[model samples]
Target: MSMIQTNDFDHVNLIEKVIENNYMTYFNYDEFTNKLEFENSISSANWNIIQNNLLINITDSENIENIIDKLIDHLIKLHDEFGYGFAGVKQIIEQNIQYINQPLLNNILDWLIKNQISSKYIFFHGFLYFNGII
Candidate 1:
């Protein structure tokens, strides 16, 4: 197993650095890549590394913009790559709505509308209503 999988090594800083540098970083990627991996890129796998290794240990002192924004960017890229095959990204967005600010949420929802996915329009309407943003 790699040092990252063993959890005995100090990989937090390394992971954080990777996240700041590339929002598309994934544990499965053998190298830091600038392009999105269509076959292996799933929201759950990416989120696993971030949520388990990085966010869980974050302190209040940490500037979380890079981490959150990177994940958001990654998800958006995934949408761009796969189009309607967005169930994974949708789940991530729904669960993370509370963590993101209104502007970022607007960006995400706007992208969804631009895609013209009927279900997403219905979904975001409910999201806005339930979150008291309507």
Candidate 2:
């Protein structure tokens, strides 16, 4: 019996697998310069918009694009609210949502999770570095 099994790999899935298998990209932010460093060319406005959108969608969206579309909403939020904070960040990862501190948001995510939004869609922060093919 062969332990290894091969499967077809789609383009985006390949990218995801690469990101999942590799080391996480550490983003650098220059507060004085309003600059963020990562592999993607995400700007400040786009980043905020993306973060806001992520917060908006991660709760209820099931589509991969819709979910990934709004990834990493709290990188800046986390950075702003808690600079270099690991406990809060770890909580977000553990629960797959930002607003664990907020009861209303927590309830919303709880409802969404009960409805079947898998962490596969809701919990990916790796898009921070992945420059998706436009």
Candidate 3:
């Protein structure tokens, strides 16, 4: 599919492609999204946590600011309460698995920052440097 249309970014379609490609992007979006979906299928609570905490809806009228801030707040709270960072997030995602997807963790941070989810990371210094969200 086309990457752009009408001089604007097609985020929804981009996300779909990212998931579909599932190659060596910032973190295998396909794997993670599918894993999350599967995990949710088994337990509504798990799904709800992810859906409510980190989920983003691509639409013209969406108030992304609120969701972004909420997600950052969630991460910050986790850090403040449990000292969680990439490791903690990885642990949550992988669950019983031995290995952790570092890229996925990085992507989460990148997503938060790139989307203005966190005001502190709002600067666009690494527009091309980042692998995930760009």
Candidate 4:
């Protein structure tokens, strides 16, 4: 009986593991324009690294891409009348736009452009333009 059983490294399993590991990590925002803060054991830097790595991996894995898409949509749906729930997520996305796939980023940008007039996301437009992502 070998204590260590070797199995093929599975990308789908990795994706699912990552998602499940972070599922309970919630968002917290004290102020806009600041880096996203999470109310969990993971530090902001760790979360940023996790997100960056995840987004980078998503470019190669359709499973990750689909899961991330659904996750973003679910986050958006969690927004309240004042749009509190996912603002931090948006901030993180904007700051880490380079890691995101072009099409997904475009969709996010389109949503931002459409809602900029009345939403906090308006603050990100200039940043994106300055960063040349817009």
Better of 1 and 3 by lDDT: 1
Tens digits of lDDT, candidate 1, 1-134:
65635543234545456567975433455323354333343212233322322212223343444433454455556467534234445554544555666665666556554644465455554544564543
**Count of backbone clashes, every candidate in sequence:** 0, 1, 0, 0
lDDT by candidate, in order shown: 0.46, 0.40, 0.39, 0.47
Q: For candidate 2, lDDT tens digit of each residue in 1-134?
A: 76976554443455456457853243334322454333463223111112232243354435544443343445446556545244435444334444323554444444444544565434433322132211
Supply candidate 1's per-residue lDDT for 9: 29
Clashes of 3: 0
TM-score of each: 0.24, 0.25, 0.28, 0.30
RMSD of 2: 15.4
Per-residue CA lDDT of model 4 for 1-134, tens digit only, reads 76966554443455446558984344343322334333442223222322433232344345533534454543354343224334444554454455667776666667666766643355555545654547
Choose the strongest candidate by lDDT: 4
Q: What's the lDDT of the predicted structure labeled candidate 1?
A: 0.46
> Listing every candidate in turn, what is its Cα RMSD in Å to the true structure after a full C-alpha superposition?
15.6, 15.4, 16.9, 17.4
Candidate 1, pairs of clashing residues: none
Candidate 4 has its poorest 10 consecutive residues by lDDT at: 41-50
Sort by TM-score, best first: what order? 4, 3, 2, 1
